[model samples]
Target chain A: MSQNLPLPPIALPGQPLAQSPPYAAGPGTYTTQNPTRTVITASVAGIPRVHADKSVSVTRPSPSHPLLLLPEVASTVLARVTRLNPRQATVEIFAIQGGGDGIHGGGDGGCVCEHTFQGVIRAQDVRATEKDRIKMLESFRVGDVVRAVVISLGDQSNYYLSTASNSLGVVVAHSDAGDPLHPINWRQMACARTGIVEERKVAKPI
Target chain B: MTDRRRINGPLEGTIPPVFLTSSTHKSIIKRSPTTLRKIFLKTGLTPPATGSAFLELPTPSTHSTPTLKLTSSVYGPRPLPSSTTFSSNARLTAELKFSPFSTPGRRRGYIRDGVERDLSAQLSIALGKSVAVGKYPKSAIDVFVSVLDCEGGLGDAGDEAGGGVDVGLMSVLATAISCASAAIADAGIECFDLVAGGVAGLVLEQGGVVEEDRVEKSLEVGQDSDDARRGMRKNGKVTLVLDPSPIDGYIILAAAAVGYMAARDELTLVWTKGSMGWDGDSTDEVERIVDGAITASTGVRLVINEAVKERLLLGLKEMGLIRGKAVSGDGDAAMS
Candidate 1:
């Protein structure tokens, strides 16, 4: 029955959707071309929707073009830690999750492009409880995949990221013996093959 | 570095400059002067680019052979480099290049000149307005245009510097704008609307008055700008041309080009050249020039709409949603 739901028409940018006053503009919609006769038009190539509140929007259609993977504030991202210092850890964001509809085609849970974005995790953003005691070496290692939230599109070169919550931190990591790590505690991860414990800011397994 | 081989210039003194001008071969203009030359455009030609398009405009007299040919390619929406400042919106860049053989005479160097740089900057600004740059933040999109042929015989007869000839620049920019928009759409980059570029010029009206005006202008030797005004104010008209060529002989008092988004009825870029009193609070002349440019752009937009719709139909056919028979109509054949 869900498959029987009719799909909305695909809209191109600049296509007129409706007259204003009765229907307000929403995301992917804009009004241009004058001091007279204001017309609501789609600004992105996507599917048009008329919400219950009488606002119109255009959501980017999925399954066509290669997804444009970009990170914005408050969005969860999966990234790999590349370098570290006492002050901050350098990371590269690889994927994004849980934004609204309009991203698709990367085979992953959400959109992933061929390129990656630069990100950083400052020492102060590693945990909420430990304001100053968190060490970069103990929190993350090179090649560890960390789940974090984007705090800000950082100054020029990197997107500021934080792994301060219980659900956010190193989700996948390897021990020195090249063994996969399993969470032992909030601060330690155990390598089952080597029977050795390593320190990491591990995320709670569901 | 090893020495690189280069092309040789034309031999000196084999043909005198006077012989070149005395051939009496006036360019053939077959249609009403205001109509655009026929355009032949096709998309998805460059496999390496995310999207690509090829465009050709044939001389009016020719059957199916193009006198102007250009190609455009679109790339990226990829990550921005770390060295550049981060922007909340996507950065758009455009580049235009003309092959040495594109002109009629002297070969051009491969290095990008000042004119190319200026044109590229204008092109970027024109296209940047039509694209929804905010949708893909922290990224860059680039459009590349290459001109294979040009009108006006620039660089011909050992004029390697390309001095004193600017009539071709407007035509080239107009073609590049329309071509690049199609390439972007082919690349699947989301845009607010497609931008079509057009050109128009102010010329003397056709009549027996040419002889009388020439004699009167010769009698008044010192009033050059005044004479130009007399042509417009008394016996001149604006000819809206979508893709203008230098071969057509016109007084060419002034010319204007515009980048228009037809669906929204917006003018994204307006550029006027020549001294027709446009800058001195002459709102009447300025508005007339702009109006002609917009009318020309509207004609070009009709062609663009059909081309884009054809692309969408091809996509549907490839997806098996439409029958192959319905997709076989070849309306895009070059109508030179």
Candidate 2:
């Protein structure tokens, strides 16, 4: 067996960052066509394309492809859990990078999204045994870049997402001085500007 | 990939270019306009004061028998655009339609498909070089082509009963641009040249094909091994046909780069013979058949003119566009 192995990641149809299957990466332009099959055609000059219209900023799907026709998925997120009351939990999330669905498809639900999450905490996860579990109330704070997983379709009217897993935690932090912080141990970092103790993720083990 | 040629034509069975700078193909319809049973004039079916024409050809009734016919209409010359090349010339528009039932199966897709796009692009290129596009800058002269009827039999020999859109073939040049030119003339667009086009192909027997090696690679840091284990391979060779038939492929096209309707040619060289899961290794038999097919298809240029064009124009005008004027004294009899 290979040593130091972790979970397997599926390689997308583009150039691989680390390593990927040779066949998956073709030697040509990867159109929004079938992300699977690569197609090539003549390059006619001066042909007007409909996608050039920017007022709508719509990324129309390829006429042949149906999958990408909808909005794109969110990638990186930043937010914090606040006021995790037993009966009701209110977690306010913020967007460091807005990875909303592409091509005019936005919102988790009908309601416009802002910095907040309000929902019922799972009854089963109400136990305050583990540190991150009990501290789920104080486990998060302002200015913390925490990772999240979509617990449910958050957008009853808006998009729903949560970062309640162990592997899913904060990645970066700033001290009172608003300077970069360095990490030494898990869940903790030393602010370079003020030397204050800050909490962030040690980074995913893999 | 280079394709092997085989002997084709309704007389014999089985199938599937002469290119110097690049390869080009033409489809040879058995009987063209000249050999057609009756002679037809522009004013026979429609008045000269109006636009367009359409025509029909006869076919065998039974056994592997299929029919071929052509129709066309013309429109044009309202204004001009400086952005175009033919500031003093005219613009032409063209379209081709293949009925769903025209072939073995139902055609699919609402948007223009790859093949359709290629055909459209080719038609535009072939006609653009001939028409005074810049003459009516910003304005277009449109021509539409539709395959009204296609039978099982093929003009190219190698074609089987079940393939292509209609499992039938067309006179590449005549069918491609016949309706196109008529539509222009119907629209009254003026230009220096009239583009003509056709299709013809070399036939080849299916031979043997060999597979290549497997490639290996690692997955992403957190990627699953199952994706690789599931087994995936390349899409395999792309099937190509030069002036393909119904079974092999059907391509009707044309061009006019010289006169008001002169000859401007285009070239294509992709060999799609064996991509239909019939690749061959030894090149001898394939070579012989292809040679014969090319030799026989040589007369396509003349065939398109005599067979497909004039007839289609008359028909289009008869059915949709204005009718032809009577031949001199036949006005009363012709109208009846």
Candidate 3:
């Protein structure tokens, strides 16, 4: 019965690894303490990894595995504009880009999200210049995909988003004639099939 | 109230009652009264659910041991109802139901009963402590538990004296807590820890005799109304048993059960039945009982971790990242 067997690196939620001063908590890890010691435990099911700085973290075995990702302040997100009101444009956030790599993990299931986070683009956060005269309907359509940065974890129901930078704004949309449109300017897009120009706060393409 | 399409029970014959009594049926395997029945737990069985698990506590003697079997499913961290006002924390809900044929007595109704409702509330409270609710604000997580088989009836412990322990309810709650935590983990819900539950009771000895030796005497005393009962009330000694079956001869002076987070050394839920006296001197007795229950939960926590790790290994094997020939039952080795 004595065979050399290596331990699997997997860590389940709530599993404790080591006491904290020597091991700082990283992503997928959270710290808790008793009267005597501070302990680090995995918050998600994944493989436990120790970094060079003695900080410990857990990472999913596969990148494609489904996991719920919450939108944090200053994180870039991909969202579809759902509707518009006088003060803000309502959007549903579907994909979150990581802070370091900018790698996107869209909603858990491919093309279908079990849970979609709500976000909002306020008139003031839409562009850097126009804080007073920005109209929600003119800047974003019902089905436009917008690249935005989360400004704040807004009210209970939504995250506040901003697209004020030159690189952020409408990434995809359709013209009134029902054709794909490309950005023609910072404020407009043109349909290739009909050559019809439409008003939008367009983003710079990479 | 009158739906002709619904099937009804027979109206003619008088049915027998099924109580949680000591079994007369002889078991093939002989075990000490203190040993817990072996537990078998597996996760990810229900494909449609976000996560699911099945649990079985089987004894060697098929007919004599009261079998406990259950399954739990977790559905979401999805959007909340639109009609509700905004909530900053994730809402957690649990529902527990017994199948119609799970028990030996009358079939259960489709609607939830008071017992089921109470257990559901307790389950939700126990699980809510471990989940990272603040992370998924404005969303809700739903857990549904179904008892496929059970050994006792609803009124089994209700009519008993204060010194009596509700073994059936304790077992059901303990199993539900363990199973639901696995399903939540399988669903990939972020949690600070997985909670494991266990039950323990204080065995009160009489005179110079040990509690186990007094089973026959206590049974005979139960037949006599007043004198015998009063005579047996004096306390001599008390010992705690981690997992006590109904047949255990101990007169349970106090019983306690808890949902324990082993890694963090915290308790999410603590349920107590019977009194450990109201006097200040009895504080140590109560603490001792609670500590015993926590130790039992650690044993259960080990088993829960093994089941979860087994699933993780299978997933790794599927990706060709790990070898497939590793033995699955190497329990203690994997844990250490």
Candidate RMSDs in Å, in order, are 7.2, 28.4, 6.6
Off by over 4 Å in 1: A1-10, A19-27, A31-39, A47-64, A100-109, A184-186, B1-26, B47-51, B59-64, B134-138, B152-166, B187-191, B204-242, B249-251, B275-283, B313-336
Over the stretch B177-295, how does candidate 3's per-residue lDDT look in tens digits? 99999888777787899988888877655443354355436646577633333444443456777765444445676788899988777898999876665444568878887888887
Of candidate 3 chain A, the 10-residue stretch with the lowest lDDT total is: A101-110
Top-down TM-score ranking: 3, 1, 2
Question: Candidate 1, residues A65-141: lDDT per residue as tens digits?
Answer: 43555677887888999999989999998888744433322223565545688899999999998678989999999
Per residue, candidate 1 scores C-alpha lDDT tens digits across B1-336 of 434596655557576546353221144564575587777788778877867888886533544233678899988787788788868899999999988877654466799987789889989988999988887778889899999887634322443221112456787888889899888866767678989888877654445447435634543563565654554445544444434566554546567889999887788899997656544655766677788888887787777656655665455444333334442332111100
State which candidate, 2 or 3, has the greater TM-score.
Answer: 3
lDDT of 3: 0.74
- Ten residues in sequence with the least summed lDDT for candidate 1 chain B: B327-336
List of chain B TM-scores, one per candidate = 0.77, 0.44, 0.77
Model 3 ranges off by over 4 Å: A1-8, A34-37, A52-54, A62-65, A100-113, B1-30, B59-66, B154-163, B203-239, B247-253, B275-285, B321-336
Local accuracy of candidate 2 as per-residue lDDT tens digits, A67-109: 1111113433445545445433444444423344321122222
Native contact fraction per model: 0.41, 0.00, 0.52
Top candidate when judged by lDDT against the true structure: 3
Q: Ten-residue segment with the worst summed lDDT in candidate 2 chain A?
A: A41-50
Superposition TM-score, candidate 3 onto the true structure:
0.79
Model 2 chain B TM at 0.44
Tell me the number of clashing residue pairs for each predicted model: 1, 106, 1
Q: How much is B79 displaced in model 3, in angstroms?
A: 3.1
Cα deviation at B62, candidate 1, in Å, is 6.6
